[model samples]
Each structure stands twice: as structure tokens, then as C-alpha cells.
Target: MLQQRFFSATSSASKYYKITLRRSPIGLSKDHRASAQTLGLFKLHQTSYQPANASTAGTILKLKELLQVENVDSIPTKEQLQANKPDRGYQVIGKKI
Candidate 1:
């Protein structure tokens, strides 16, 4: 019915728009930090992807003032993402995960 179609459309729309935080926004304006916080991005080089919707796109546009974004169609899962990066800086701090 109508509900099913709506759900299907939402599910299909969930597969695009990869948002990556290529650089840190430290020492930037408070507004930039707030935008990043709104997007759930707090660390450097932390990347997240959302559906290509108006709200998400708008958030990216706001974040662009302090971030480097690439329009990738997809992004790796959190686990896959953690596996690729080395623990160089953390090793000195005696942290390994």
C-alpha cells in the first residue's frame, strides 16, 4: 500500500551520499564546531555517509566551511574503517585496539 511504498523509497534512498571529514576543524570558529557536532563528527579525519537527502546535503554544505568533502557514492563500515588505519600515534600512548 502507500506505507509500503514510502518505506521502500526511504530504504532505496539510504544507499548514496558519502560524507567524509578529510581534515580537522580545530581552532576554527564556534559555528563550524557546532555544525560538526550537529553532524556527529568530532574527531579529525572521521568520515560518515548519509543518504542524499536535503537535510543531509544542507548539513554538508554548512560543514563545508570547515571541512573537505568529497561526493563519494559509498563509504566503508565503521569496523572496516578502523581496520585500515594504523595505530601510530596511539601506540606511544600505550593504547591498542
Candidate 2:
């Protein structure tokens, strides 16, 4: 019973895809660019997480030539992404009181 429960728990965990835009969309068709935009990739080297499913798979396949994809065990939340970013070297020095 314990073994069965463990297997089920692992199986129920969701899988994610890490997609990074590696190429520019210049000269590409409007539809292809739109598809990439729909996938939340707006800039070069930007990464987005999406579930491993048919629709997402189709989108990735459509833009495969312009993107790099990897299977990730989990997705990072927005806060996590922000936290992972490096701090800017300069801070705002003045503000209206």
C-alpha cells in the first residue's frame, strides 16, 4: 500500500516546460510571431514556463526554430523569477516629497 501511494504521488506531480527565446522573429510570418507572443516570449533570452500538454506542445513545435526548450520538474513563480534576477547596480537617488 505504501509503495502504491508513493508511485501515485509521483505520477500526480505536474511537468513543466522551460522555453527560452533564442532567436529573433524578424522576417517571420505574422502568425508565427503571434504564436510566440502568445507563449509569453517577448524578448530574446526571456524564459517562460508552460505545462506539458498538447496545446503548449503545438505552440512550441510551431516556434521550435526560434526557441530552446527543456523539460523542468517544476515551474517558478513570478516572485521566484524576480528574486532570481540580479540586483541593479544603481538605485534611484531622488524622489518628489
Report the number of the highest-lDDT candidate: 2
- Computed on alpha carbons, the lDDT of every model, listed in order, comes to 0.69, 0.90
Tell me how far the alpha carbon of residue 32 in candidate 1 is from the true structure, in angstroms, after superposition: 1.7
TM-score of candidate 1 against the unseen true structure? 0.51
| Candidate 1 weakest lDDT stretch, 10 residues | 7-16
Task: Estimate, for each residue in 1-97, the C-alpha lDDT of model 1 and write its tens digit.
Answer: 9988665654334455655576777887888778787776878777666666778778788777556655554667789878998866543656678
C-alpha TM-score for every candidate: 0.51, 0.67
User: What would the per-residue lDDT of candidate 2 be over residues 1-97, giving only the tens digit for each residue?
Assistant: 9988665656555598899999999899999999999999999999898998889999999999999999888987789889989998988889989
Maximum-TM-score candidate: 2
RMSD value for candidate 1: 8.9
Candidate 2 accuracy as TM-score? 0.67
